[model samples]
Target: MGAASVKPTSLPISELLSSRYPARVPRYQRAYAWNDTQVGDLIDDIKLLLPLPAGTRGHFYGGMVVIKITDSSEPSSNVYEIVDGQQRLATFCLLFAQIAARADELKDQADSQGDGEEAKKLAVLARGVRKSNLYYQRYDVDEGNESEQPRVRLSRVDDDFFQSLLDGTAGPPSRESHELLENAANLLRDELVTPATDATDLADARGKLQRLCDAVLLDSFVIHIVSDSRSSGYRLFSVLNDRGARLTVADLLRSHTLELLDDHASSREKAANLWDDILTEGADLVDDFLMTYYTSLTGKRAKREDLFDDVKDLIFSATKGRVEILAALQKMSGEVSTFKAIHAGMWPYVPSEHMQSVTEWQRSRLQRLVSTIQHKLSHPLLLAARAHSREDEFAKLVHMLELFALRYKNICGAHTGPAQAVYYAECKRLRGLTNGVAANFAALRKALNTLIDKRAPDPIFRNALKDKLRYDGGSPMKANLKELLTVLEDYRPWIKQGSSGQPRPSMINLIDLGQVSIEHIHPQKPEVIVPSLTSHTNRLGNLSYWAPSDNSAAGNKPFALKQPAYAASVVSFNQDLAELAAWDLSALEAREEQLIHDACLIFRP
Candidate 1:
């Protein structure tokens, strides 16, 4: 328990690491995987390394290989961590596989026509190289030891792109966006993987590259923080979070304060101290601390990253120093009779309609009614709302206001942070209710956390929305963007004016209106299923993304419906979201031109 020893020294990569050493996986680092090009190019590099010019000799693989090392303490074995260069190691294994494959191919071609004894000898060496590929080994998911063998697997991104590039059949867009993918594909095709002339040399190079990569990169001098105890390591782990990119909104805000308050040096120190004091003060559960902070904001329902720019005070964090916590304390304590004057700057962004329900005089009366009990219950109330949304799946206790509303004067009392914490725990345990009280609260509280934490909802889910909503094939607007823009230009007057004659900014960008395509639930006449036309017609109502693709395929039949031998052509339905207050799909059949015209209006700035 005394101060433990601490030291860091760089050793030759191999000397620093033990065979089994793996870095203490940083909390933010993703799991191991290598893309096809990295893997594919690596194999090709070994085949060509000997022939390459001296200037480019080490260029393929020299970078700082950092890892942390821990000595065998009183209890555990010595350990080393790989901080960088994982991809290089994995790629080396891939090179081994390709070298092996090329050797076998050469041997077979030579043997088939009795070309020479060299072909037979080459086959043997290729097998040896192929057998050494540890990272590419197929995953034996359930067998823990089988996966550790030398092999490589191409990443999902690499496989698809390489296949397309090699085939030369993927005619993707010519736009700025598609340019990168095409370039990457072209690079892989040209630089990665080559024809092998001598199977034996190719085989030798693979093994050498594999051993070199494993020794230098995997075993290299990477920095790992270590102490004598396991628990101490856990404490050090917290610093990794503090320093890493997986920062919470609160963490970002904490960092932002420094930049914002720098102007007034004294106030800057004050802001830093005050903010931490408030965060530490009467801390409930960490989650609730986040909820309380977010509940105090405007646009409480939007994503956090979306709204982080509104933090103007962040620019002044240096001046605010510890005093910045005053903003939070004022926001929280302002409802009391003693603090009315403190809130002159806080009210405009307050969203609750009920904030208007309490006047200064009434706040004073409420304060007198419960001198010791806090009257402000919004923080805990928001937790209750979140629990309610979860169908009481997470209900832990009665909300603070709900407790107060219990109607027995003696039992109905305002709750403290500690008491609220207990109630939150109770709500987490609350049971089934059909009224959705639990669910409503659950979603709202989640929204509160998003407001506070400030991260984007995962992009995976957003892309999933595109597929679910069927915005993939073509534009929901005109098939071509230029033509569609021309059509939209004709409706400028209809779009630009709002009800009050002021120019209303457009909502067209909310979803990509341009990319939407009009799909037919029914196939083209020859393909249309004849049996249930009525049920099918309404189902095939056309929809599109708010962006590039629009109603190009409207009234066109799906191809499969006519050829019964082929699969029955059912239309891939878009989610059919309402662009207007009362937009419906029937408009696609009758108001086609008008629909396009109206949809374009949604995007006007």
Candidate 2:
């Protein structure tokens, strides 16, 4: 049950796959995640050996760690659970599948050309490649019943998709991992047939494919590390990682947490599966989720490099026994759906008795406001509030956060350090709060409003709104500017009447309009430049959202010429601009003043 059962053996990939035991990536293992760069690099390295002389020493492909999951010793009866190097092994399987299929295509071409000898040679090469692929990828478990099992079985999350790739039945990828797998397959195909190496005939192509197949199957080497127990396998995996092997923060956390579980094998496996589900849900953002979740609970900053250490400390400090530790993780997993909804800028409807009072509109508005601002510093606070506070309190918290962000982040250009400190403090408080605390909301509002007044007072916001705000398409100010204009568009409709002095049209979600573009009221390249007003061309007061076609047609035109398009626009902000008396410095200043005043009122915390 420990280190004595661990064994290490060096083997070429050929021997490793040709063994009787079929390799299985345990359910807890992460899915195939090699990007195009990694896949291309591996292929390039393998291709480097093709030009070398025959019978050269095999290239070292690194280690593959596995554990014998079953005790049966009969041929093909044992399953080696892959603990590490699945990425490399899965990638090799993909490459072999492509080679076999390409060889088959070449064989078919030769047969059609009436070249019996070439066809026979290609058919044999195809079969050889197919056999190697079967050893690494899939083969029949029962010859009589024709039941088959993959030699290197991927996790349940990806086994089906990986199989489809080998069988050439994969459609467009439906998830991030699937996309990476598809990209890897496509990259291997590209490397297999480059422009410089493309053959002129079926025979030459067959030769080229055979060379690649041989290079892969006969020339690659790996250190096959085996263990008889899961705990030993994980310990070996961690030791290898500590010795400079690359593993992600999420991977380390999962491994460390599982290592702490002093339980039966079934319980350990269940915990591993639960961790995988959480990891899979987080996907690329798993590390961020871990950091934010831990920091929210602890009221301390968790850097990316120190995430595992922080979580480990928190686990030890918060739990007293094995059951409590597992429950702690289960509680953390429950918040994943909420975190995902916030990350995606969408309000998820989780049915709960306390959530019935929280209307969809309020939730939608909260999400839209945060999304428009696009700030991650607010995520931990929001996540903590959702987890600890009642649904209505969470809604109120969102509104306060939106106002603070609009003034402090969007308008006044302040550093995130100050706001992050306040947010973290609030998150810590929220994490400890019981349900239905009206006094906490009052204290939170006071703290946020106080911070707003200090960081982005009316005078500061006015000064920044006057001229410091500028946005070209490529500038980072584009998001803030869009958020400002969208809010103004909404605000203007409520306060101003229609063209016929009737009620204003209902407010629109200007940010979501597909064709909307930020148009300059005083065009960037006007027909006749007013020297006094040229400096104000890209200012906040000079910009409004317009349809792309209208923005284009009115480009660089004078105020009078642009007035017709603005008047016909659907946006209230644009329509109001059409009512200006003249396109002069005085007019720009007056409008700027009005906007500054309204912005202060609209965004005041």
Best by TM-score: 2
Cα deviation of 120 in candidate 2 (Å)?
Answer: 2.8
Model 1 Cα lDDT, one tens digit per residue, 132-241: 33322333434543433222222222333323432245576333213444544443323543432323453354444344344333333334334544334333433444
Tens digits of per-residue lDDT for model 2, 312-362: 777743244667766776886777767888889776446654476666545
Per-candidate TM-scores read 0.31, 0.86
Error of 1 at 383 (Å): 15
Worst window of 10 by summed lDDT in candidate 1: 405-414
Query: Which RMSD values do the candidates have, in order?
Result: 21.0, 4.5
Best by lDDT: 2
